[model samples]
Target: MRVAALWFPDWPVQAAKLECDDELQEPLVIAAQHRVVVCSQAARAAGIRRGMKVRHAQAAAPELTVIDANPDRDGRMFASLAGSLDDVAASVEVLRPGLVVADLKAAGAFHGGEDVALEMLVDAAARRGIDTLAGAADEIATAVIAARSGQVVPPGESAAYLARQPLAVLTAETALAADADTVKTLGQLGITTLGELAAIPPAAMTTRFGVHGAHIHRIAAAAPDRRVAPELPVADLAVAITPEDPIERVDAAAFAARALAASLHERLKEAGRNCVRLKVVAELETGQRVERVWRTREALTESATADRVRWQLDGWLTSGGAGAITSLILEPLELMAPDAVGELWADRASTDDARRVVERVQSQLGIDAVLQPRLIGGRGVAERIQLVPFGEAAPPVEEKTWPGAIPAPLPARLGGGIDHPASRVTLIDATGKPVIVTAEALLAGEPYALAWGDKKYLLTGWAGPWPVDEGWWASDANRHRVARLQAVGREGGPQGDVTGWLLVWSRRSWRVEAVY
Candidate 1:
């Protein structure tokens, strides 16, 4: 039941250093909520220490480079090392950003002996440019302290070793057992050390702090159950299909992929696993094999998984390859527990199956064929409303303030009806003169009527001459001096009802492209 713990001092700072491409010469510190968590070696030398206020640390080291602490980044970066450590420790459990606990006896036995195993673990971590310290004891709690303090305790000596240590050694265990205030309470009670706290009857402690206090008592006792628990096993989900006939076209194969994806996703849901990577393998009728991998930052829903498969098949078939998919296989490469993030980082809840139908349609039609309008920074309604491929991340929409950009209540279509059929239209003033917007963002006349083809509608209300002047400095630039307006009007067709429309003034004329 020996426990082994690996501790990476200042792991957040270490992870940040690894992530940043530039050489960081300045004293650096990772902070969260104005509290210092980890600081660089130079920052340490400059008297910037952990537990110090961020302001105090900055004051200590004026040249300090303060980095916001991100636990997700630390965990994500460490996940890349899981495969490498699998051989070293068969059952490794990640405790936090800097801490890992494993079965000491098993890990040591795998690499000859305990000392050799610790040495191997250190060497392996060093090779990856991660500084790690190893410590082993009969109990997990003792092992954590040993690793943190660079000490190793003999078998059955964990309790004695922990007795001299302060209660602060539990800093990295997360909020599982006790809160930080509990430590202060213990010290205030004259239980200044682990030995003093351990001496208290477990029953009395439970009466005071409930289960958490009892947990602390057990850890202090260094019992056998203190052994590290292995991480939950990920479910391996794979789906394969063989159609009655060899599917030659991407359109036909997509249906099969969609069915298989749905089945795989349902199985994954039942098993409580979410997939992030899909490996699509197709066996062509000509006996040639095609395989492609697609990965997403977020876990893929059933439809997204199908899209990746379809996209892969589309590329493979459209390349003039002499193949149709006789057999298709879908494999999930990575699976994560839905509750692992708890929606703090990502939504843990499963999406509705109805959304899957819409996404599937977008997949079948091709990314370009289906587009979603995004409000990017531009002057006119048409210019601001750019159509992007459905399901793709919207391009930088509000990256910078395009000062006079039209505000929301956005239009669904643009002039000549971009997303719909085009029609001839005329916009006129109350005096029957055509409405126009001057270069100085002044309207020539108030709009009173709108004429489209054979039907005409009366303008109900109007607002704004919001102006935007863009690209005026460059000679070759397509300079635009545009004004925007919002209006409400009823259509000439039956069941006519007043609806909002986002209108724009461009090329000395006014036009509306949408009914909001």
Candidate 2:
């Protein structure tokens, strides 16, 4: 197999700074969650380096501007670049948040061999204002190093080619540094070449470096048994977009969605598929994401996909708009090959027809307006069934049943109707132990004080303090942490009704564990 490894050096730091006020071409570095993320070539020239302490980095280059790395944004943008490559390659596999490897056996041969394919990739990436280094060899590992080193190894000579490279290239360490004065490159090792490295006793290497040392030996030797699978075809298409201008207005975002949908349509067409799962990514100027996915039918036209994008964008904009919009992307998670027109009878629903229904409903009602039940763990009604995109795999449900917990329903809607008519309740003395709430005080009487908001109110009527229990066997039961109470309103309502349900809100509901 002709394997190629494409490397995007410093992609995260570069992608993160794209939206910053600064051009980011000079000495720059990114600190992610308060640790060194990456530094530019200029920063390296200034003695500032990747993984350096933030304070130390500043000390090295006083003018260096630092931006916190946004991993999510960088990941989505990298995915977009991968999706764009689908137009030229048979498959595009994402490697982490930055790198992607494209199989060239088919695409390369069709494009006039490997050199042409590499050049094509360079051109494609250049159009997006990206600089990438690519290299090809018989073994995937050899290609990875060549791409990083900006060298291409000829086929059938990977072992000889890799022998001259440094051992640091194969080591998995993210921060490349030497431990001792005797530091030597892979080429300088006793096993002077890859062929020699392969001849080293595997048991000895394993004892010395554990599994990692064994892996290094295998890569150096060009292990014949190792297999690099072709890029896995995307199970579902997903997309995200960032606009050239900040979207301050809601309607303006709608216009951006139209463009994104058109782009997605082109991708789907090239993939020979139609989609039911549509994901919309809205990049906020704050650098946070307002993303949601919905179940829909196969989208036959670019316009249909655009309509769904418009719906999601409008929903996000109207729901507080999240300050400003930067970009939008549409992805189809559930997809099928588009059907031939007039292939089926009118009474039957073809794949295309089903896809159309999904798109229409998604376009009409907002994407969030329609939901599919996904099982989740929790004793609360709202915590049980999760809303997810239709046709997508439901998240695995776990056994979180507490011995005496209230049985909750799956997929509960919030703030709709009460079991009974309007009622009222009140607090008396509102202090500690066996807290008192009197009926008469609520039935046209006044309470001395209220606790939560520290406000006083007149009581009218009363309801039972419904008790809820959870995690009976755990330590939570002893702490009074497993219980919840629901109370009616003391005042503040049209006819004095409960506005919110108060619960101890168990921590288990927040951490969901899924079985693979």
Candidate 3:
């Protein structure tokens, strides 16, 4: 069967770029254990290369920014690309972060032909700002070689094409990297070339290298026998719980979710499956229902699953959801075999400590105090994270366009936010003048400082004075207009205390909205 190999050259660097809100200008490289793993194009031009010692790379390009290479982050980011490929290909096998092999005939036929299919897939990658290189051939190995060397071998000419290539060519694709070791072994056996290795009888090769030897023999002959595997369809596996009495207490709801999650885990394990995506459903006594979906790239262990369920319940009950839950359900939207997922392990001590704290907090304070905030985007700091009782639905913001919605890298704050009712702060412009907004959504001036209690802070860097005209066309005198600013500062001057703050202009004056 014809197959195609697609390569993403610098996936780790690309993932970092996507996660960063600020545009990275300096040359950057991702290094693992003092060795360069991947480098930006600019870094390459500055003499940085993969596998180079990090110290040498840095010394060569002093301004190069180094980022740690994280396997988890790479895998998580690649899932989106894999999902996109799944839509257009009949079968796709992920080799690693940067390489995937797909059934070319099927994807090609679906898009009307091979070239058009590659174009469509390339366009899909471009939509996500991913650069990709692709090539096709009759066999998987040939396809991989073609992709790396920019060749499209003829259907029946894979053997001739591969025979002419050096053994080191195998190192270019992740799928063949492991087998490349066998190539090295073959070198020891006085067979350093593909044609030389192919002349060895299959039985002798197998005798020398076991199953892998037999596999490499076929590769040397340019005859690949492999099929891409498709992703498993999501299964709807659900388990529900109904308490005899309405579950009013946070502890009671948390207990119910924990038990249900454990049961769901056991059931799936018995069936040799695991869940990565789940939906929580809660039905309240007042007839209100709440639902939310949670997903992770890694497989959810029993405790992790329960924690999510408990968090959902906590938000529901604490948000003045007004009624106790009558019933709750845990359902898996996506399922896969356990081995297929990578389970991220956390330290047991820290995990248990965190669990104890959440439990103790819910017991001592009232449920409202043990709330969880749902992260979202909005024009105002107050609208960015909606605090609901730990297991409840967050307060819904209107779906209309938030013209002045702040970009990410949101301000960070603790305990009831910046307007915490127990603290106060003032927003001032660069001239040490109070910042304000007029009725027309116009800012009085750019914010440059903050005055909180007795500590004075001077702004260093900032963005906005983003304007919002909400309810501006109202017939009555209820029209409202506001301007928002995100300013960062330090306490004594530009060097004392560094932090980020969100400031808002409304009701004719400005106030500190949140601290980050």
What TM-score would each prediction reach against the true structure?
A: 0.46, 0.43, 0.46
lDDT of 2 by residue, 1-516 (tens): 776666777886656554342356567788864557787777889998667898888888888888777644564455444544655666444434455556667668789888888778766665333457887777666777677866778878888887777555654322111121112433456544455666778897778554445767777777652233332356555556666678766467657767667566656656767765455667777888755444332243555555545545554554453567777766555566654554344653345455545554454444554577765755545455678865454545666655543333222234321221221222453332223323331222232322333333333433333334434667854643323334334444345433333322233211111100
Each prediction's RMSD over C-alphas, in Å, is 12.9, 18.5, 20.6
Q: What is candidate 1's CA lDDT for residue 243?
A: 92
Q: Pick the candidate with the highest lDDT.
A: 3
- Clash totals, every prediction: 0, 16, 16
Quantify all predictions' global Cα lDDT against the true fold. 0.67, 0.55, 0.70
List runs of model 3 lying over 4 Å from the truth: 127-129, 177-181, 230-516
Candidate 1 deviant stretches above 4 angstroms:
32-37, 49-56, 127-129, 172-176, 226-516
Candidate 1 lDDT by residue in tens digits, 1-516: 877777887778777776663355568888877888888777888988789998888788788899998754565455433324555776565544466666768977778898887777766666334567788888766787788777889987888887887776654455123445566677788876678788899899889875557877777767566345432345567889999988887678678868887788777767767775556678888887755444453467666676656655655665464477789988776676653222332332234222343454443444466677786666556666677876676645457665665667566655564333343356789789987777667778888877766767788888887876677886645785656678776777334767676766655555565557
lDDT of 3 by residue, 56-104 (tens): 9989998889999875456545644554665677566655566777788
Error of 2 at 408 (Å): 48
Question: In angstroms, how far off is 310's CA in candidate 1?
Answer: 23
The RMSD (Cα, Å) of candidate 1 is 12.9
